[model samples]
Target: MNVEHGVHDAPYFVPSPSRWPIVGAVALFFFALGAALTVNKVAAGWYSLAGGLAILFWMLFGWFGDVIRESQQQQYGQQVDWSLRWGMSWFIFSEVMFFAAFFGALFYARSIAIPELGGDTLTRQLLWPDSQAAWPGNSAPTSTSYTPMGALGIPAINTAILLTSGATLTWAHWGLVRGRRLQLICGLVATIYLAALFLALQAYEYHHGFLDLNLTLASGAYGATFYLLTGFHGLHVFVGTLMLCVMLARASQGHFSEKQHFGFEAAAWYWHFVDVVWLLLFVVVYWL
Candidate 1:
């Protein structure tokens, strides 16, 4: 533990250099390339994508294992903890901006593009003479039927599930802080169960929308925005569920203490964020 002028100095833990970042980056490159190729129907793309996903999963497992070991060793001091907090905070902020972009696109398409297309004579003459630029607007170049999804069905149920999950997560956090291991474990299990249920119901809803209701990515502007927003949010929920599972495993292993457990805290924060985002999605994408 190196210290500068003894009075003002504190031990700052700098982890030894690791190869995980580079490995992860390379894996992501392959994943992206393979995904693009798959979308274009290139040969071997599926295999390439599967391989890349396997490598990425390996990298995450190794990297997270190392971190857990370091935490167990108490290698991280308050300084390191503060650094981790700041890092997670910034990462979450970046995620917020990421979702904001898609929301903005939805806004633009609804408030500006759809209205203009419906109102302007030139657009009507050139593109859709008989189409009305109403929401879930009939802007598709082809004649594919579409039905807008209502907020009163599976979406409403999912909202209730997310809200309940958030409450259970808070209960788990309380247990963690109070050193009640059983309560913490139970709460986490409940949260995970709820998340799985949410995902299942959402998948069912998507199926209903696509296959039964004739709502699809190509239905019109509404279809495009609808799927884009819900799809990305669903992905976030999936990632958050994985994080919660990891936290649950660590909690069961006695890896977290009352005063120190940023791993769990970070996961909880992310889950709460996912919950908040879904609420917003319900209001804007589904209700409005």
Candidate 2:
């Protein structure tokens, strides 16, 4: 049984012991600690956060490098492929649940908390006599006066950009499946450019919100929910763009074939997930 080579006769390829898992755990610990400290206004927290990010990136590069090498050596079998598929599926599902939790919070704030507080006569009289049961109420203690963000302008453009990126990503997938390397690379480049543009425009919109509209985290529930949803989605878009960049590099290196390209497919799945989430956010957060 040649474990290193992952002999075809073996039931499953089991890798030897590695330090990456513990390293990753340590990195996460620092990340969490740094985040907590930073939130409390500790200056040293920046250094800790930067260090943690460096360690995390190092672990990712090393760990993924090993997996890629193993894959290129044909160490993975059909069972391993299926395992990877299931693993990616579950990861995406967990992400879905994460976003669902935030959306649930938004629902609770809008449907139950706000209405109960404002609609009840005694509760309103005792608690917040000046507050109204509005969707974007300016009644919180820390609330700042601001104009609500609309569905037009940069948001509309960003929506189109994300939708177009999704199309370009699908085109890349088609090229990969057809064994058209040039087409695949071109499509990936277009998708990456679009993704970057979307992020840039989002950043600009955030700036506009904070500077011109006075929309901020302190601007009551509307601002909080707006940033929470859109901010996280933007992070996902940045991550997806990085993933697409990795796929582009792999494709350029002649890594994937017409049949075996789970890495590319995994990135595509993530990008599409980001796109769908943005659509939901556009409707729930901006339009309606």
Candidate 3:
């Protein structure tokens, strides 16, 4: 544990040169390109997208495998651990900013654009003379029926599920710290189930919106923002659930220790962040 010691106790650990980063970049490029092309109705785009995802997943598996091996070998000391913590923190901060951009868009559209388009003063009278100034706004130039989503239904239930999952995740962390293997496993399993259930309910909500409610992206600005925010949050929940699954798998293999489980802590941080973002979304997008 000495800060200035040799290989076994070095404070810093530098990894060997990696091909994974370059590979990941390539995979991402293909994936983005494919997605764009698919959006434009290109037929071959699916193949490229699938291929890219496969490659990306393979790269992640290999990269994580190497890191896990190093972790098990105890190659990382306190300084290296600190570095990991800092790295994960910054990553989460970046994710926060990413969500902030979308939330800002929602705010701007609601507070400024909608008002300017609907107010009686100048622009609305001149441009959209027949439009109503509402949160969902006009469905389109053709005026399709629009029903705005409220916080009282599926959104409320999903919010509760996420909050509960956050609690379960915390309980699992406590179990990990206390070395109660059964408690930790049960907590993680419960969290994962909650996450999956939340996703299922969200999908059902989307189905209801599209079929019964007619809330499509093309429905109006409200539909766009609602889907944009909630859809991305659902994707985050999927990712967080996957991360928890990995953590649970590692826990089963006895990979984490009470003092040195940054992996679990990082996943927990991300899950909690997702939960908080959902709460905000529930208020702003669904309730407000």
Candidate 4:
């Protein structure tokens, strides 16, 4: 290796300062303000929220477009690639902690809070005489009437759908590794379809819960936990689907090669994390 060439490659690539960060901060300010106002029933909150979401999307597309162009131009060296992997790993870890907090809430509601409330004679006699230490119906301070979602129907089907998507994504990765463009594209298409189907089923399930079963966020602890877990997971699935769609577009354009495909791998990691969260939700929120 030439000494000068080696020295030149040693320095990592640094992108020039951009306006996207400030734009993102402004978007987040709108989001925060919008959320606060909306929670208090302010009318303008809707417009603010919409504007914030639009700005956020614009920032994401612009920033990601820049990165994609840089990657395509081969500006990202192995150092950048390794740093990206680490960044993605930390991102997934943060997501894990985020879900963990929700799960902790569920566990606390079920195992600790409900039981302590029901089991204490003085507390129950004075506060919630009718309350019982139950999983679904009477778990709250007052009796709540709503059908609890079960694991038998849509939940089970969604489980299988998400698991299958994981498999298809893996197959796509294998195809990319083997330099089979057709196989990769087909696998990604299948995965995207599966993900979309899962989202559709979940939406229908939510509709059924609200309309026919009278289940909602107002239905007390069960409803709150159910929607919080499943709704957030659905959002994750939606995001993962979008990421896969982008990957599919790039793959169609012959972007990723056999050796360099961290973008696809990052998306795959996130999708698998979503799948695992759904599995836990199925067992805990629906079945158990």
lDDT of 1 at 129: 71
lDDT of 1 by residue, 1-288 (tens): 334323432776667899999999988988998999999999878888988899999999999999999999988877778789999999999999999999999899888777767785787788777767788656666838777999998999999999999999999999999999999999999999999999999999999998898898887778888999999999999999999999999999999999999999999999999999999999999999
lDDT winner between 1 and 3, please give it: 1
Q: Lowest summed-lDDT stretch of 10 residues in model 4? A: 1-10
The residue-by-residue lDDT of candidate 2 on 1-288, one tens digit each, is: 234335544556787789999999999989988998999999988888998999999999999989998889887777789889999999999999999999998999899878877785787778777777887768475687889899999898999999999999899899999989998999999999999999999999999999999999988878888999999999999999999998999999999999999999999999999999999999988888
- Runs off by more than 4 Å, candidate 2: 1-10, 36-43, 139-141
TM-scores across all candidates? Answer: 0.94, 0.93, 0.93, 0.93
Off by over 4 Å in 4: 1-9
Pairs of colliding residues, candidate 4:
none
Write the residue-wise lDDT of candidate 3 on 1-288 in tens digits.
Answer: 224656544467778889999999989988998898899999888988998999999999999999998999998878788779999999999999989999999998888878877778677777677766677657346647878877798889888999999999999999999998888899999999999999999999999888988788987778888899999999999999999999999999999988889999999999999999999999999888
TM-score of 1: 0.94
Between candidates 3 and 4, the TM-score winner: 4
Those runs of model 1 whose alpha carbons end farther than 4 Å from true positions after fitting are: 1-9
RMSD of 1: 1.9
Q: Rate the local accuracy (lDDT) of all candidates.
A: 0.90, 0.90, 0.89, 0.90
Which clashing pairs does model 2 show?
A: none
Q: How close is each model in CA RMSD to the real structure?
A: 1.9, 2.5, 2.7, 2.8
| lDDT comparing candidate 1 with the true structure | 0.90
